[model samples]
Target: MPTPDLMTAELTLTGRITTASNATFLGSIGEVEVVYKPIAGESPLWDFPHGTLARREVAAYMVSQVCGWDIVPRTWLRDGPFGEGMVQLWQEQDPVQTAVNLIATNQVPEKGWKQVLEGQDEDGQMVALVHEDSPALRRMAVFDMVVNNADRKGNHILAMTDGHRHGVDHGLTFHSDHKLRTVLWGWLGDPLTAEERDGIDRVTEGLNGGLGRNLADLLSVEEIESIATRCARLRLEGRFPAPSGEMPAVPWPLF
Candidate 1:
């Protein structure tokens, strides 16, 4: 649950993150760092309803909790300097860690990494998109599948020193339609482990309980149901799904 201090604290904005598409602020509550995305600053999208991104973000966090993977950082909705928005505890990723990378096509290692795609760069040099084949990253891929994440770009994954991976920028998630755009398709046909199956079971169980009620406040009836649908579909398949929509499989600006 989001603490009242997060909503009532004097949020002091330290800077604007120019890289983000929507207005994003770096702020602090006493000593805790947080990222704020005001609802007013969100640009309209043809596919998504207006001013609902913040709610989707909070919903993603709630689902993350149900899975017990800690794939997403703590997130909540709150009133901020710019108005009501989504606030998430900022994770300080390990600067030396590289969970995802683009490297020369020939340089891809045979083990410990999964190559996603190979393409030519601006200068026509061949490069391959790859990510570490670690348990932490694979768990994040399953989480993305459950959430219907539409923008799981390389930069959205934060690598930590303790080998944990955190996913961010979940505003483009939970849509009823099949709108999964991501770079984590390395496990397209891999079988789900027993642990992974248990995680999905936990999510299905959560949908019928408190988690369902909490999501009702943030998402539409159809969107909430779609979450259950996606979970059931994934569990039935028992493997990472291949892209099946007309839209591109991966987000642009892969890194």
Candidate 2:
């Protein structure tokens, strides 16, 4: 569908996503299904220390576009039935496909996956947090760093039928701090592939052009400048960074 239609079209609320931390709705603009999150319904947890969560979600989408990774689904701010909010094209993920999983430690596949952390479950069974070792997820990890995503929970990654991964719930992003909480730390200290470095280079160049201007509407000057700084540092380091000791490395509820 066209952009104007999504923006001005009448939004009908079909259902509510009760599992979301903030007020999230499953709705549609005519025949096109979409997710609408009105700013008024946002939880206070995300409003603090930064801009509105709705705008931050859009900011993440813009950065994802720069990476050309399709990490985030198409998202934008639009007027809805309740009020102004963020509207994103809803994706029907493959029910059987799972990019991230928590498996018994001893059962973890030695190949085709990487183990991130291990601990005991409530029942005292040892388990490990693991993710598929694939190019698509690698690109997602790189994209997460650029956006400073603070809440990359397992459910945020949508495993698609074509093996593509779409990341959602970016309300806790671009905080202008070292808050990179996520479950994608399996590649810590690994060398950045040539393709990953090239993606960062494209973002750096974009910062000086349209990308920078576009972010200004959703993020503060400090937050926008931080993106450039992050890109430069990643380019210089040429490796996936380990978490800073000052903050939590991974989000709670691994999957």
Cα lDDT computed for each candidate against the true fold: 0.93, 0.90
- For model 1, state the Cα shift of residue 121 in Å: 0.7
What is candidate 2's TM-score against the reference? 0.96
Clashes of 1: 0
lDDT digits (tens) for residues 1-255 of candidate 1: 454387688888999999999999999987889999999999899999999999999999999899999988999998889999999999999999989999999999999999999999999999999999988898889988889999999999999989899999999999999999989889899999888888888999999999999999999999989989998998899999898979999999897
Compared with the true structure, the alpha-carbon lDDT of candidate 2 equals: 0.90
**Model 2 segments more than 4 A misplaced:** 1-4
Put down candidate 2 lDDT per residue, 175-228, tens digits, no spaces: 787789999998999999999999999899999999999999998999999999
Clashing pairs in 2: none
**Cα TM-score per model:** 0.97, 0.96
Q: Which runs of model 1 end up more than 4 angstroms from their true locations?
A: 1-4
* Top-TM-score structure, candidate number: 1
